[model samples]
Target: MEKVREFIVIPQKKPETVRDLLGWHRKLLFDCLKQELKKRLIESSITELNRLIGKMVPSFEGEVLDSAAKLKLQSINELLQEAREELLVTKKVIKSFYKSNETIIAAIVKSHMGEETLTRLRDQHEDTHPNLLHEPGWMLEYQVAKEQWDKGKAAFLTFGTFMDPAKADVIVISNPLDEKIEFNLDWREIEESRE
Candidate 1:
């Protein structure tokens, strides 16, 4: 994996509604995914091209290229084209999945963390500017809310920083309402399970 990169957004003020909070969460995750996806696609293409060149270099040792060499080159080009097409298809699939489930995900988040609590938390952090995620007061509030409501299987939004991107610690919004719904955004696990 490439050096883990971060894409963060700090709201100048607190979110007015649960919808707004969820929107921020979704935006952050999607932005990060796009960044990571671009990096991975490039890395994959480079790796494939390097492998092709490694094979071609040995075959070109004798100077005179034959029909077999030409066919091999054609096959290598086809493999590269296939890899590019697969990456594009993967991108489309991810976007489609995100769009299809966006509304349902928002509804689920709203239900897990009620509007009243969201409003209360927003009011509590009304004065904290820009650094809501890092503010001591907001952090304390988040922990308290998690302990209080999470015990009852409720949910709340939280922030994390300097975490491993590959380990799925990207966004740790605790949603304990439904046991079957794994809200943990582990991209690897999702892909593995899908496979």
Candidate 2:
């Protein structure tokens, strides 16, 4: 088994009301967080092994499997079913959070730049191009992602001076939210808090 590197995000600064926040700052921070988190999550999986065992209980081979093999397959299937159920719930929660974030970013944009500017930004975001790296309408994506990272919500990366997770995150606790929250990295971990 290969040991994968893990990174956690701990916020250095958090804006309460988005008073002076800008979309580009969000973009920069969110992009860095995203890359770090993604790099951490690519652990080994069983897809190849399951596919290789043809004619076995878990494979497409039309042969009869032994009792032990059948039991192993059954166990794996049960685990997969449980994972799927959890995934559905997590997806729902994430989607809802992102939707709320869109509204929050829109509010911030309108507050700073007015409704007309917000409308134009939305239009630009909707007009996605294949090669476009950053959005002409930067308000939508970055704000939510950055806000989440800023708020110290990403499981894998910790805020503060960048420290590698191999030594356990040495986070300088700043955000009150960070002090109140923790991540177990078990993937089944979900956080809920009152606003």
Candidate 3:
């Protein structure tokens, strides 16, 4: 099991103005608080989803238990479809939660830190990182960001429920570990291609 580590940042002295806080520090606090709220909401949805999975799994046992056990694609599809819908709604709610709370959090940060610090922080770009799981292709994305970062270009975040691959200026898709060969054509015009 993975341990959930939480951090609390306490200022040594009372903050007289927002300027006392470095821009990254303010972002860290904001991200921490926002992440916690997201965790609670996402956990609730996952708990129910897990329960549904438990109840539904036995229903599939029939296909393996008996020689005559049948495969019911409709039942399986319906189960997955429901799960997808639940997750999609959860994703939407989480994104909306961030959108709504960010402003209030920013205001609080500005009050404690100051308007100038907030302004600079908003204008600054930060690196994007992967979560603990380090989901596939994250490092690739980080690398791409780093390339842009090295050239003194800004890297910003875009929050959404789905990827707009078509509109993305950069895309990094890793091939599977297994060997593969494909004779195909990519119609899109790409720049700075890499292997």
List the lowest-lDDT window of 10 residues for candidate 3. Answer: 157-166
Find the number of clashing residue pairs for candidate 1: 0
lDDT score at residue 26, model 2, on the 0-100 scale: 38
Q: What's model 3's lDDT at 31?
A: 56
Task: For model 3, name the residue pairs that clash.
Answer: 17-113, 18-113, 18-114, 19-113
The runs of at least 3 residues in candidate 1 whose Cα sits more than 4 Å from the true structure, single-residue gaps closed, are 1-46, 54-62, 109-195
Q: For candidate 2, write residues 32-73 as lDDT tens digits.
A: 445333323321123433443433544636768778877877
Q: TM-score-based ranking, best first?
A: 2, 1, 3
Candidates 1 and 3: which is better by TM-score? 1
Estimate the TM-score of every prediction. 0.35, 0.40, 0.31
Instruction: Give the range where candidate 1 is weakest over 10 consecutive residues by summed lDDT.
Output: 161-170
Full-model lDDT, candidate 3: 0.40
Instruction: Count the clashes in each prediction.
Output: 0, 10, 4
- Cα lDDT of model 1 by residue, 75-189, tens digit: 7777777666666655444444333233233344345666564455445544332222334554464566457544553333332211111111222345433334423244455
- In Å, residue 11's CA in model 1 sits off its true spot by 33
What is the overall TM-score of model 3 with all chains considered together? 0.31
